[model samples]
Target chain A: MGLNLDYKAELDNIIRDHIDMEGPLLPVLHAVMARFSHIPKDAIPIIARKLNLSSAEVSGVVSFYHDFKKEKVGRHKVQICRSEACQAMGSRELEVHAKKSLKVDFGESTNDDLIFLEPVYCLGNCACSPSVRIDDEIHARVTPSGFDKLISDLRSVNHHKARNS
Target chain B: MRKLFIPNDTSAVAMGSNLVANRFEELIKNKSLDIQIIRNGSRGMFWLEPLVEFESDFKRFGFQSVDLSEVESILEFICDDSFDAALNKHPKFLGETESIEYFKKQQRLSFFRSGLGDPLCIDHYSSLEGFTGLKKALEMQPQQIVDEVKNSGLRGRGGAAFPTGIKWQTVLDTAHSKKYIVCNADEGDSGTFADRLLMESDPYQLIEGMIIAGLAVNANQGYIYLRSEYPFAHATLNTAISRCYAEGILGQNVLGKKICFELEVRLGAGAYICGEETSLLESLEGKRGLVRSKPPLPAIEGLFGCPTVVNNVLTLGAISTILCKGSDYYKNYGTGRSRGTLPVQLSGNIKRGGLIEIPFGISLREIVEDFGGGTFSGNPVKAIQVGGPLGAFVDRDKWDTPMDYEAFSAINSMIGHGGIVVFDDQINMFDQARFAMEFCAIESCGKCTPCRIGSTRGLEVLDKISSKKDVEDNLILLEELCDTMEHSSLCAMGGMTPFPVKSAVELYKEDFT
Candidate 1:
C-alpha cells in the first residue's frame, strides 16, 4: 500500500486546476478521488485551505454525499438499482442474490478486495428495469445468473492477469 | 452501400447493443461487405432495444431485440435481392421503424432526430433542422424570445408546472450584469428517463436550447447540473459541449453573431434533493446540497446570488422547437392550458416500455394500456404510480383522469416529470407506502424538521400498522404527521411525500386492514 506518492504536490495541482472555476470544491474532490481511489484524510485540510473554507466545512461536504468515499474500496465498484422501477421488476430478489453471491452486504468490499457492492437509487435506465453498474458498464435486465456470469468473468480475467504477471 | 443503425444509448447498451454492433463490424470485416454501421441514440422503444435497423433506398426497417444469433440472420436478410420478400421471411423483422405502431402514434417534437443517425454528427443534426431555432433566436430581441416561449405555453417539464417563459422573463427583467442559466439534468426520479434520453439522444438540441435561453435572458454563462448516476449522459454532454465550442456554436462568438455564452457541466454527488433548484445551486457551489428557502426565487438571486434562469433539460430542450417552428406550431399539439408535447417515460413491469413524446391531457389509462401495452408479467394492472416517487399511487378508478397539471391535481395526483411506474396485481400497496416514507427519510437534506424527522416517524407508524398494533390510532397519528409535513416542510421532498401515502391508504383500504 506504501507507494511513496507525493500527496501535497498532487493535491496542489488538483486544487490549482479547478481554483479558477465557479464552483471548484466538488470538481477538485472528484478529481482527487479519481486520482486516488478515495479522498485521503490529509487532502481535506489542503482542499479547505486552497478553497478558503474551514476543515469542518470541507469534511461536512465530504460526509454529506454518498459518492465521496473517505476510505479505499475494492478494485471494482458494483452498483445495483434499488429504486421502485427495479423493485417492480424483482430487484429485491436480485439484491438478495447479489449479497449472497458476493458474500457481503451493501457498502462492504469482498474479503479478497475484488468487488464492492452498493445500492444505487436509480441509473435512469428504468425502461430496462433491474439495472446494475459494474465498474463503468451498466447491464440491464440483470438476473441472478447474469450477475453471476459477469462476476465470474471479471474474476477469471483478474486470475488470468495475475497468472501471466 | 447500405447502412445499419444500432443504438449506443444507455438502455440499448444495457441490453447488449454494443456486443451486437461489434459483432456486425466483425461479420462485415470477415465477409468484405459494403455496409456502414451507425451508433445512434435509442428510438425509446426500450423493450425492443438492441433494435437493429437497416437503411437502404431511404427506407429504414428494424429487427427487434437482436442478439448475436439474430445478427447473423439480419445480415442474410439485408443481402437478399428484395427487402419486402426478405423481411416477410424473417421472424424478427419490424417493418419501417418510423411506421411501427409505437413510434407512429407518438408526436415527437424535441426527439425528432433520435435513433436517426449518429447523435454527435453535426451534419446529421443540421440536416434535420437542428440549429434553425438558434438561427431564428439570433435575429430576435430578448423580449421577443421570452414572449415566444410564453405564447408557446411551455411549462417547466421537470415536475413543477410553472410556465417556463415567466421564469425566463423574471431573470431577463432582473438587473444583473452577471446572470446564469442553469440546466437541471439531475433526472433522479425512479420511473423517469426523459431528461437522460434528451441529453444522450439529442444533445445538440439541449445545447441549442441553452444558447437560445442565454440569448433570451442576456446571460452569458450556463451550467448543466448533471447527476453522477448518468455517466453516459455526462460523456455525451462533454463531447457535445466541446464540439459546440469548436464549431463556434458556443463561446465568445455564438454562431458568429458576436454574442457571448459559455456552458459547462457540473456533476452532482448522488443527492436526490439536488434535483430541487436551490439544492442544485448549493451542490454546484461545491457544498452539501441543502435546500434554500423561497422568498428570493432562483430567477431573482441564484447561483452565487445572481439572477439565474434555471430550467429542466426538457424545458430548455423544448426552447429549440418553440423557436424553430413558431410558437403557434408548437402550441397547437396539446389540450387545455397544457400546450406543447410532453416526453412521457413509461417503465416498471410494463410490456411495452419506452419514451412517448405525446401532448398533455391523454388519460393515464391510455398511456399505461395503449402505449405501455399493460404489464410485463401479463397480470392485471393493479396500481400506477405516475410522476415518480412523490407522485400518488392512483387506482383503476383514477386512471381515466386526463394527465395534465390541473386534472391530476383534481384527483390528488401529479404528473411529476411525466414518469409513470406501473405495478401488477401482485404489488402490495402498504409496502409501497412504507417505501415512500423510507425514501423521503433517506433523501431529506436535513435542513427542515418535518422532512428530516417526520419521515422516520411515518415509517415507524406504518411499521406498527403492519404489525397489527392499534392500527386505527396509528393510522390517525400517521395522517396527522403527513398533515404536518405537507403544511410545514421546507420543500416538495416532505410536502408531496404525503401525496403517495395518503392516496394509497384512501384508495386501498383493504390493504391497511
Candidate 2:
C-alpha cells in the first residue's frame, strides 16, 4: 500500500529473482501481486520486457487467472464460496445477503472502499458449506446474519484503530 | 490439572471452534484452573465440531459440539478437577474418543495422526509415533522403500488412482542425476477436503511422505503445488515444514543421514485445470496452467524438464505410514486393486459430514447413510456425485455399489479424489449437468479444441434444451458433443467433463426432456 505509481524498481527486483526460473512470467507476476495486493497496470510492460514477452502476453497471463486483479480493490476483501458444494448448502442466499450487507455486488467495493466481495469456487471446507473468506482467514458455515456480524466486527476494528490513532 | 483437546482444523474453525477455544481459555484463567487446552486437528466428525475432549482416567473423554455459550458450564464441572463424574454427565459427552461409532468404523492407517493432535507442534506429531516412518526409511535401501510402497498398493489419491510406487519406480529407474518430487496439492474438487485436512491437520505426514518420496526416487528437492484458495493450509504447511526443518527431519541431511531432502510450497494462481500433473508442473514453472500432452510422461520429463515424480497429497501422505507400519499392514485393509484406506470426504448437504477413512469395498449406502448419517435437511436423497466436478453422477439405484477405483470404473465412473457430494431430492439434475459443462468451459486451457469449444457448445445446447427449444434433438446433439469431448480432449478436464453431463442425462432424462 505504501508503494507509489513508480514501482519499477520493486517490480524489477521481483522479476530478477524469478527470471532464471524455467518459465518466469507466472512466478514473477505472483511475486508482484504478493508484494502489492494487486498488480499495477504499469508493471505489465516491465514484466513483459524482463521475461522477454510482449505486453499483451503479460496482460493475458494476468487476466486469465481469476486471482489477479486488474486494478485496486478495497482494504477488507470478502470472498464467498460460489462452487456447487456451497451452493447445495444455500450459498446463493448467503451471496445475496453478503452483497446487500456490503452494499456492493461481486466485483464492487463499498462507497467508503472498506469491503470488497468476490466469488471463490471452493474454500476446501465443503462439510461446513457456505464458507466465507474475510481477507486471509476463512470462516465456515456462514449465514447472511453471520456475514453481517463479521463485517460489523471488521468495521468496528477499523473504527477503534482510527480513534486510537 | 486436566488436559482438553479441541480441534483447530479448518472445518472445526468454521463451526465455532475459535470462539469455544477463546471462551474456554478465558474461563479457565478466571477460575485459576490448571487445565491445559490443546488445539488438535478435526476428528472428522463435522456435525460434532467444536468437539472438546478431556483427560479422564488416562483416556481422552469427549464432548460433542460444545458451543461457546456452554463453555462456562462445561468448564464449571471441569475446574473442580479430579476428572469429575459431574463433567462426564454433560449431555454432549460421548464417553471416550475411541468409543464413537463413526470413528470406530474407520480404517485409519494413513490418517492415524490426523485430527488427534496439534499439527504445528513437533512434539504433538512426534508424540504419536511421527518420525518413525522417516527414521525407518533412512535405514532401508531406496529400492526397499519403493518395494514397501508398491507392496502396500498405495495408488495416487489425486483422482487418477495411478500406482504411486510405479510412478516412483519410473523416476527411480530413469537414471537422471537430477530428479524432483512434487506433491500436487491443487485440490480443486468441489466436495473434497481430505487433502486440505491432511495438509493442515497433520502436515508433517505429507512432509514425511515427500521426504520418503525424495529418498525413493533419489530426488533431493520437492515442491507442494498448492492452490491459492487454501490460505489456511498454506500457512499450516509452511509452519509445519519450518518445524520439521528445525527438528532435523528435513533439510541438508534428513535425520543426520547422508541423504538430503528439501521441500517448498508453490502457490497456484486460480486454475482448476492445474490439478492435472503437467498443468501443475507448468504452473510451478511459472507459466500458464495449460495441460501438456503426455508422451514422455511427468515421471520422465517434469518440473524444468527433470525426471519428476508427481503424487497427490494423499498418495505421498500414505508413504510414511506404509514404510513405518509395514507394507503388509497397509495392504491388509483394502480389497482388490484399491488397496489401503481411502480418506473419503462426505460433504455437501450431508448430516454428519466429515472425513471417513474406510478401506475399499465399502458401499455408497454405508458411507452416505451410516457414516454420513444421510442428508442434513432430512430430505430424501436423490443423486450423489462420487468424484469432483468432472466425476459422474450416480442415481439412487447405485447406492449399494461399492466404492473403489475398479468398481467405480466398472460403472463408467471413478472415485476421483474420494469425495462424495450428496444432493437432496430438491436438486435439478439438468442444472447440475449444465454446471459440469460450464465448469469445463471456464477452466479449459484452450490448448485443445475438443475441451474448449465442445464445453461452450455443450453449455449452449443445455441452455437450449432447458428452454424447451427442441429438447429431444438438443439432448441427442449434447450426447454427441459429450462423446467428442470424452474421446478427443487432451486431458481429463475435457475428457471427463462428459462423465457428469452424460450421467446426469442418463439418470434423469425425464427431468431434462
Candidate 3:
C-alpha cells in the first residue's frame, strides 16, 4: 500500500511532539498508535530507525502488548469486560449476545468498518456488572438486549455521519 | 449558595448517581433552590455510592445510594435541615462514615485526599492539601527527596514489595540524561480496585506523585499506562491533567520553578498480563503484554532503553503523603518493615465488600470477621484469598495471620495488592483451584515456555486431580510443575499463578483427594 505522506508527517509530529524524549520505546509506540488509531506495519521501520533500535526490538515491544493493532481499525471500538467481576455479573451471556448482535467475535470487526469488538479485563464497574465500552464511553449494567440496542444506535449514528460526509 | 457534591465515579454512577444528579437539577429548576451541584469522585465507601454530600457549616452530611426517585424527599429533607427517616440520613440511619469501625481503624495516607475534594477542580484539590508534596520535593535536592522516601520504607504496592526509594535511587544513580517515569495503572487483578479507586477519586494526587517522582529522578516526561477497563478514570484523569496544566501544576516550570514535567495517559487494551511492570512497559510501547527477562531491570535500561522508574499507582500515590506527612509520620502506622497504612480492598462473598484502609499488623480475622461481617450469604467462611486471582488461599485455620507483609510471606502468602476475597463454606476448593489454573492459562501472555505451556499443563493436572483421575499422582505432578514455574518463569504470571493452586491444594487437600 502507498504511504500517505501527510498522514505519515502528522504521525511523525505526534511522536516527536508527545513521545520523542521518553527513554522506553513503548510509550512512544503507544503515543504513535493513540494518535494514528493503529500501528502501521510500515511505521515500525521508521520508529526503529528513529530510536536507533533494531527491527526485532521494535517488533518485540509491539507484539508483546495486546492493544497495538497492525491492521486498520474501525472508527468505533467496543470492548466487553471478561474479567472475573464481569463474569460473576453474567458477562459470559452478554459476550455471546454481543457477538451474535455484532456478527463478530472478539478482535474482529464488522464488514461495514463500524465497530470492532474485543474482550477486556475489569473496567472497575463491577457493581453495575457486565460493562462495555463503546469507544471511550463506558456503559454499565449492559444486558445482551442493551448491547444490541447500543450497536443499532451506533450503526445509525455511523450511517448518519457517512451521509453528512 | 447551597453547595452539593455528587461523586461522578463509576461506583456512584452504577448506584444511579447520574439519575440522582439529573433529579437534583430538575428539583433546582422546578423549586428554584439556590443550589449548585458538582460531580466529584467516590469517597471509597463504595457500598454507599451515589453518596450525596450537602455542605452545612464546615461539616458535610452524607446520603448513601440516593436514587432519582428519592431526590425530592432528599432535597426537601436537606432544605428543611430535618433528618428524614425514609431517606436514611436521619440520626437512626445516619451511620457516621468516620466513626464506622471500618473507617475508624484505617490510617488512610494514600487515600487521604480521595472523596474529600472535587477531583476536577484544582482549587478544591489545593484547598484539601494537594500538590504540597510536589512543592516540598521541588524545594529539596533530588537526592534528598529520594533519601526521604528511602527512609519512609515505602514499597511497591503492586503485589511485589520492592522498595520505591531503592528503585528511584538506582535510576537516579544510573548515568542517563533521558529517564522516564511510567505509572502502571493497569489494575487488571480481579479483586484489587485500589489503583482504580485512587485514579478515579483522586487523580491529582497521582499526578502530584508522578511529578514528584519525575523531579526527584530528573525525568521530564511520564506516562500513566491505564487499563482500557477504566474509561471513566481515563476521562477524569485527562480532565485533571488539563486542569493541572491550566493552573501551572504540570508542564513548564511547575509552581514557578524550572522543573518541567509533562504527563500523558496511555490506554492498554484489556490484557491481564499488562499488570506486570515489564509487560506494562511493553504494552505502553504498543505491544502485547508479554513478559521480558530481567537483569537489566527497568531502572537501568527501561522504556526506550534509557533509565526509567516504573511504579504501581498505589506506590506513587503513597509518595505525596510520605513527602507531606514526613517519613516518621508514615513509619508510625504499619508494623516492622511494612511501615504504612495499606488501602485493602474487601471483595467477593463478603457482607461489606468495599475498600478499607488500615494500618499494617492488623489480623486477617479482624478484617474478615469484624469488618467484613462474615460472608454475605450468612454461611461459615471456608477460604479467603488475600491477594488477586494468583494470590494464595488462606483457610479459616489460618485466619489469625497478621496482614503485615512479613506475616503473609511467613505464612507463604503475600499481600498481593491488598485484595481480600472471601469465599463461603458452599464454595468448592477443588473448583476454585481449577479456576485459578484456568485463569492463568487464559491470561498468560504466552511469551515463555513455563507460563505458556506450563499453565495449560497445570490446568490439565488440576482437572485430573479434581476429577479423581490418578488424583494422588496428578496432585504430586501439579506441585512439581508449580515449583518449576515459580523458580523458572520470566515474570510473576507463572511465578504467582501457582500461589492460588498450591494454597488451595495445601489448605483443602480433601477436596483434591
Candidate 4:
C-alpha cells in the first residue's frame, strides 16, 4: 500500500487517530488535507488499507467534496461567493473581472501560484454581497475594481516573499 | 479603567474589524490608557460595523467603523471627562447599544445574549439568563420536556417548519440505547446569517440548548454539523464546547446530575445539499453529503442508523428560551400554528441588512420597508425571495402578505429559514431564474436525475429564452422541465430548485418575454 515516502508519518498518525471512529474516512481525509494543503493521491492507498475500505471508496469521498483538492492551492485562496444574494449585487460581473485579472477560472490557480480563485455558495454575509474570502478573511461589498485591487495586493505580497527567498 | 469591545464576527471582520481591533490595542498601549478591548460577536447591525463599544458607568455606547487612524482619538474621547456629551455629538456614536431603535424594536428571544458579551466566558453567559433553560430541563422529566416544546408550537427554522416537539418525541419514544442529538449548523442559504450569528456570538447558548435537547431526548451524545465557510464560528464553538465540558455542564453527570452529554462538531465540505438534514447526517458520518430517502426520517433512523433528533441551529437555540419562559409564553407571539419569534435575516441589496427576530405574522412589506429601510440602490424593490436559493421569487404585489409558513405556502412561497433576499428593479428575473437552475446544477449531489440533469437543461432553456431562440416553444419546454424536476426528484434539492424558476416566470411574466 506504500505510495510515497513523503508525509508517511503524518499520514500514519492521522489514520491511527481516526481509524477507531465510526465512519473514519472523512475525518482522516480532512486531517491529511490540513497537513498537506491538498490530499495526496499516494496517501489514499495507505488510508484505504488502514480503514479497510477500498481505494475507490476513499477517493470517492475526497473527489465528491469541493473542499478536498487533489493538488496544492496557491499561497492565498480567494473565494468569491456566487450565490443568489451576491448575484443580485453584480457578482457575475465581479467573477468575470476576478478571473481575467487572476488569469484563472473558478478552480484554477495563477501561473505565479500567488492566488487561487474559487466559487463559494454563501459566506452568510449576504448583507455585504459580492463578498470575497482571501484565505480565512472575508472582504465585503467588493466590486470588479475592488477585486482587481485585491488581486494586485496579493500579487505584490507574493512578489516580496519570492524576492526575500 | 474602562472596557471596550470589537466584533470578531466574520461579517465585522469582513468590514475590517480585525485591523481595527489590532490598531485599537496598539494605540491603547502606546497612549498608556487603562482600557481593555474584547473581540465580541456582531450585534447583527452590519451597516455600521467594526462598531467599537465602550462601557461607561454600566451603560455601553458605541462608535461605528472605527478606523486605524481614529483609534487613538476614540481612546482619548472615551477617556475624556464629558464622555456622554462627546458621544452625543459624535456622528458615528450610536447612543446606547441596547437603545438603538433597530435593536430595541425586535423581540430577541433566541438571540438574547448575542453580541452582548464575551462568547467564551461562562460567567457573562450565565448572568444573561444563558443556562436558565437547561436548569429547568434538568429538573423536568424527558416526556414533560417534550410536552412543553409541543405546546410551544416551535417549528424547524431550517425551512421545513416541521414541529420541533414531534421530531423530539419520535427520538424520545424510539427504543434505542445509544440515540444521538445532531444540530444542523450548515447554513448555506444565501440570505441566512441568523444561524452563523448565534453560533459565533453566543456559542454557549447553542451548547446549553443542545444539552437541554440531550436531556429531553435521553441522548448523551450530540454532534453539530457546521459549514466550513464559517471558520470564526468553528473556532468559537470549539472553545465554547471545551468550556462547557470544563464547567461540568457537558460531561458525565452534568452539573452533578445523572445526565451525561458529550458534544462534538463535524465540518461540512462546501456542499449546499448538506444543509438538508438527511444529507447533513450523511456528511456527519464522514461520507458524501447525498440526501437520504425519507419514511425512515432522520428521527427514526438518522446518524449511524440509530434514532437521532436532528434540529436546526435556531430550533435548538430557541430551546433555552422555551424552557425558561414556558411553552405558553413562547406560543403567544406568532399567529396560528407558527408560534414563537422567527429570526428573519434581511440581506442582499438591503439598506439595513441584518438579523431581525420577530413574531411570524409580520408582513413582508413591514420587514422590507419599515425595518429594512428599502433597497440599498434607492430603486424600487422588484422581487423579494423569502427563503434561500430554493425559495420562490415573490413579486412586489405580494408585499403585504404575512410571512408565516401557511401564508407563504399558499402563495407558492415559503418562509424557509426566514431569509429575505431583496432584489432591486435593476435585476432581471429571467437571469435570476437561470441562476437558480445553474446553482442547482453546480451543487446537486448527482444522486437523482431531476436535480442533476434537469438543472443543467433548465439553464440551457433559460439561455434559449433569453436569446429569443423560438421563445414561445422554449418557454413551454422550460415550464415542463420545472414540473418534472418538482414532481420526480428524490429529495427537496431536486424538488425545490424549480421553485425559483417557476415563480420568476409566473410573477414577472414580462421578464421572460
Best candidate (score: lDDT): 1
Query: Which runs of model 1 end up more than 4 angstroms from their true locations?
Result: A1-5
lDDT of 3 by residue, B1-513 (tens): 877888887777766688789989988999999998987777777666677887767667677767667788778777775544443645323444466666666777888777776777778877877878888898899999999999999999998999999999999999887899999998888767889889988888899999999988999999998887787888889988988889888889798898899999887765788889888877666555667788789999888788999999999988998898798888888888998888888766666667789888889999878887887668887888888788888866778988989999988888989987777776677877777777778788887888888989998888777677998888889999999989988888888888888988888888888
Any residue pairs clashing in model 2, and if so which?
none
Which 10 successive residues of model 1 chain A have the least lDDT summed?
A1-10
Model 2, stretches more than 4 Å misplaced?
A1-6, A13-27, A50-57, A100-103, B81-84
Q: Chain A vs. true chain A, TM-score per candidate?
A: 0.94, 0.91, 0.91, 0.89
| Per-residue C-alpha lDDT of model 4 across residues B1-513, encoded as one tens digit per residue | 789999888889888899998988888888888888887878898877888899987988989877777787787788889876775666677778888888888998988777887878899998988788899999999999999999999999899999999999999999988889999999998989999999999988889889999999889999998999998889989999988888899899798998899998888888889998888888888778888888898788999999999999999988889998899999999998899999999998889888888888889999989988989989988889989999998866778999899999998899999899998999989988988899899889989998999999999999999998999999999999999999999888889988989989988989999
Question: lDDT per prediction?
Answer: 0.92, 0.86, 0.80, 0.88
Model 1 clash pairs? none
Top-TM-score candidate index: 1
Position B353, candidate 4: lDDT: 88
Model 3 stretches with alpha carbons more than 4 Å out: A1-64, A68-80, A85-117, A126-165, B81-97, B285-290, B378-380, B425-428, B464-468, B509-513
Tens digits of per-residue lDDT, candidate 1, B311-364, equal 999999999999999999999988889999888999999999999999888888
Error of 3 at B400 (Å): 1.8
Model 4 — TM-score against the truth? 0.97
Better of 3 and 4 by lDDT: 4
Listed in order, the DockQ scores are 0.85, 0.66, 0.30, 0.75
Candidate 2 lDDT by residue in tens digits, B1-513? 688888987788888898899998888888788899988887778888888988867887788888877888787766664546676677786887877999999988777777777888887788888888988988888899999988888888999888888988899999888899999999998999999988888898899899998888899999999999998898999898887789778889888889889888888888898899998998787667788999889999998899999999999888888888899998998889989888899888889888999999999999999988888889988888989898898867778889888988888888999988898888888988988898888889999999999999999999999899999899999999999999999999999999999999999888898
Instruction: Report the C-alpha lDDT of model 3 over A1-165, residue by residue, as the tens digit.
Output: 335898789767766764544454666666766777788877888787777888887887676556778777777888897754455445778998888877888899988888888887666765445678787677766788888888889989888998999
Clashes of 4: 0
